[model samples]
Target: MSEISNNDDIRTILLPSAPFGIPEVTANDAEGTWGLRRLGVPHPDVYAMADIVSCTVRELECEGTAGPAVGEARGMELLGEVLKNPGKVARANKYKGGAYCGGVYLEVTLRDPTADKLIIPVWGRELKRGSMAYRQVIESAETVKAAFDEMIEGGSRG
Candidate 1:
């Protein structure tokens, strides 16, 4: 794990690697950008990505939207798809937007058209408290990793 600080307002965490050669996850408090990246690479190679604005989580939860739950489910589904067949996902590129998932948006895009590299970008509003968003992002990233681990160990889809 690593901590990156650009200024007083911005704080970023480089999370541990996910199971099965998955890319590294990152969470930035200030910009509300968080997701997976293949580090030690030259270009911008984000395998999976997500962002959230301040107070978005609280609002969704308060409004009885179950935003976090929905987000996790969708994230897991996308991750499974990516793991199973990245090339198919890259060619289809159908995962995007989250209006149906109660504001927890997930977008899958081909970062490099020449290569089969894809990036999954999820977006929600944000959390209110300091570091809440950061923590939540970490939680989400960890959840993905754990699920992936479970799938690997148990031979089941997580």
Candidate 2:
């Protein structure tokens, strides 16, 4: 009898970090699935759903806050509405000069049943003078919300 061995190289995925030693998300999420599972994605699908919902809310708030020009407080009222809800699983915060002359930072989070947390951020900077700051904000919010609705309802099922 002859002895034989199988050799193979294992591959691993690398994820990008946010900043300042904050852990990053590296998992490859399956389409239409959420959370980690040995066989596949786990139950409840909170992470994915949270992402959709948070993004939707952010867009709505941004639109509300945006105005005709930079430094205008057009969307502040809408921003307030989005901030009403916050907890461990999901939240949105306004970052005030935390780093890099930080302006308005919108953050959304989702905690999976497995204790894994997913955080998404929409960083905003006041537009230049006469720039399309308000228009951009409103457009971006609309785009994001539309995308979320499409994903949830399985793609423009009109």
Candidate 3:
């Protein structure tokens, strides 16, 4: 894992690159979130892991301190949730957003154990619309799911 320190002193953890050309996974200590994307890709589609606790708190109109420990706890909770249904949980919790800078076409699919898979439609003015983009999305999702599986099995967070 590689670490990057921002001006705010938040350390961004770039997890090991996914196998088979999938984008790398990034974990943020401040926001308690993770995402899959190619570095330096401008306005790329957002393929992010969701933290239900944080989402729920936001939805119910709440806030909290942006501390490292808080983020660590949230990350642990997210891991636990993913452990429930590694395959389906990651797909369900994955957040997809458009490539546009200002106007994002976001699509979030809820968790459904019976569903085969969640399809995230890419949208953005600058998005490269082709087989490559489509394949990247699919591969990134699968990589994330696999990462969750490995993390749960190994009892580690990455």
Best by TM-score: 2
Error of 1 at 137 (Å): 18
lDDT of 2 by residue, 1-158 (tens): 00112123211111122442212222222344232121223332233433433433332132223233222224875455446533311212221211122222223333334443333332344332234664554454354344444444542232
- Residue-level lDDT tens digits of model 3 in 30-116: 554445455455433332343211111001101221223222346778677667756544333331222212111212332344533
The digit string of per-residue lDDT tens for model 1 on 1-158 reads 33434446433343333332324444434443444565455333322222111111111222323233322346679788778877655434322232222122222333345653233322244333235554665456454434333323332221
Which ten-residue region of model 2 has the weakest summed lDDT? 1-10
Q: Quote model 1's TM-score.
A: 0.23
Cα RMSDs of all predictions?
18.3, 15.3, 21.2
Identify the candidate with maximal lDDT: 1
- TM-scores of the models, in the given order? 0.23, 0.30, 0.24
Worst 10 residues of 3 by lDDT: 53-62
lDDT to native, each model: 0.37, 0.31, 0.35
Which 10 successive residues of model 1 have the least lDDT summed? 50-59
Give every collision pair in model 1.
Answer: 53-125, 53-126, 55-126, 55-127, 56-126
* Local lDDT at 126 for model 1: 35
